[model samples]
Target: MIVFFFWLSIFIIVYTYAGYPALLYLLGKACRKTKEYEDYEPSITLLIAAYNEEDFIRRKLDNSLNLDYPSEKLQILVVADGSTDKTAEIVQTYESRHVELCFQPQRQGKLAAIDRAMAFARGDIVLFSDANNIYEPGTLKSLVVPFSDPTVGGVSGAKHIIKDENTLGESEGLYWKYESFIKKQETRLGSCSGVSGEIFAIRRALYEPAPRHIINDDFYLAMRLLRRGYRIVYVPQARSFERTSYSKKDEIIRRKRINAGRYQALRYFRQIFPLKYPRLMWQVISHKVFRLLLPFAMIVAFLTNGLALVPGLSKGEPSILRLTFPFNWIIFSIQSLFYLLSVIGNISAGKQGKLVYLPTFLVNSNIASFQGFLQFIKGNETALWEKVKRADNGEQINA
Candidate 1:
């Protein structure tokens, strides 16, 4: 039973991180590339939800105004609900640029802000954006092209973490690159399971006001479209850039909140099961569900492997190396070394190369996920989210 559990845990970790992506790669090769997108220009409302984002709102409005899309066709709306700072004031200044501001005095959370703003949105497509998302000139054009296909219900653009001198920035940039690849592959396979909240668009008519408790609004919104039998694809060319989290600690806070919301969102996706939608079910389970179970699997693998190495020691074994020779010597050694490096990397906060960053990031992320699970169980997370600080005070680098 010990050996069985050890192997099962190892399998879960491997399949979640590696095997699933490999399988997607192989299956995606058989799927033909979609070339149905055209020079499509549908009326779009660029909705920016701002909550005390005074640091980023001005630049974000400027960026939005400079987009290559026709000004007449695009309606720039900034929803500053419960913002006590100069966010609403700054947005008001943009009124001369034909930018609209919808300010609600009470802080009802992001979903509520979006819901209220949607009522005044005068576009066929609603593009959800964050204050920190700096768009390239052609991003808007690329984003809507996929909508030319009637089946495509929503489209998510790629998010690039601007690489900085810090190791965290580099690792985060690499992580997003990996995610972008997976989204591309998933899009080719048919539908992407989720989207980046920073940049995604859905038909305005399909917008539904979710319950006040829906914490992971982006995933819930995207999946709701899928549940309605519409396809959501990844648009790699529609790129927006933002800096990394202010620090490792901030990253963990952000990740924990996201993961907690993901756990809470499981109930919303209950109907998208294997029997009704086999391919989608496989994708969601492999891509999203397995991640939620990973920390537990890691704990099981570590404990089981450690226990397997204890028998010889109980028999008064002399050398530490000789204790587990017949049992889990190799696996135990690898785990031990990996964790040692993780400890060192954590202390140093990833000052080293990919060798350290890989383990540091992997361990920290899993810990955050576990913390998020606990938060979800305890109902500690709320719909109103506090913003995580970004590196360099959320300044936009030239994309």
Candidate 2:
């Protein structure tokens, strides 16, 4: 029984991160076909929900105004709800440029703000964005091209993190790159379940309002469309760039909020059972559900692995089975080393090596996931979240 648990835990961890992606890669290659798209210039409403975003609001508006899309067809809407700063003032200044502003004195969270602003949206497609996301000039053009295919109900763009020798930045950038690869494979296999909130667009007509309590609005919105038999295409060419959180603490807060939202989203996605929606169910279970459950599996693997090393720990085991002790020691040692590296990386704060970054990120993120689960249980996390400070200190450079 001890050995059974240890191996089961190990398989859960390995299969979540590695085996699932490997399966997707092989399946992607088998079902690969040239994706067909055309010049699709649908009327788009660029919706940016901001709260006390004085620092980046101007830059974001400027970037939006100068995008490659036709200004006549594109409507840039800024919703500054619960903003007590110059965020509203700055957005108001852009009124002459035909930039729409939706402001409310009370802070009711992002979902609420979008709900209020949705009444003013007049575009065929609505592209959601963050105040910090700086897109390439051609991003708008690329993002809309997929809508040319009626089957493509939504389009999610790629996110590139701008790193500047910051350890957290490096880890985040690497994480996004890995996510991009998986998203590409998932899209090739039919559709992608994940969508970066920083850059994603869906038809305004297909948009069913998600619950106001929803935390990960982007994922919830995308999955809603997917549930309706619509495909969500990931367009790598439509890239948005942003810097990492100002510090590890900030990133932890952001990740905890996100993971908590993932937990919250599970109840809403209950219809995606294996029998009803096999491929979608497998993707969600492998890509999202298993990843959320990994930290617990790690805990089980560690505890069971340790107990397996002790003599006669498994009550019914015969003395002859003691030969397995050596293998247990090896596995235990590897786990210990990983935890030790995480400790070392945390102690050496700003180091920029893969040895430090990978272990620290893996451990810290898993711990955050555990914490997030607790938050979800406590019902402490809400749609209204604190803004995470970014490493970019007011630089206006385009990526």
Q: State TM-scores per candidate.
A: 0.94, 0.96
lDDT per residue for candidate 2 within 40-125, as digits (tens), equals 88999999988899989999999999999888899999999999999999999999999999998999899999989889999999
lDDT per residue as tens, model 1, 1-399: 666788889889999888988888888987766556677999999999889999988899988998999999999999999999999999998888899999978998999999999999999999999997799999999999989988889999999988776777877888888888888889889889869998999999898888888888888888778888888999999999988888888999999999999898886666433336789879988988999999999999899888877764323344333334544777888898888877877788436888888887888899999999999999898998968888875445676
Which candidate ranks first by lDDT, i.e. highest? 2
- lDDT (0-100) at residue 178 of candidate 2? 89
Candidate 2 TM-score to native: 0.96
- The Cα local distance difference test for each model comes to 0.86, 0.87
For model 1, what is the alpha-carbon lDDT of residue 10?
88
What is the Cα root-mean-square deviation between model 2 and the actual structure?
Answer: 2.2
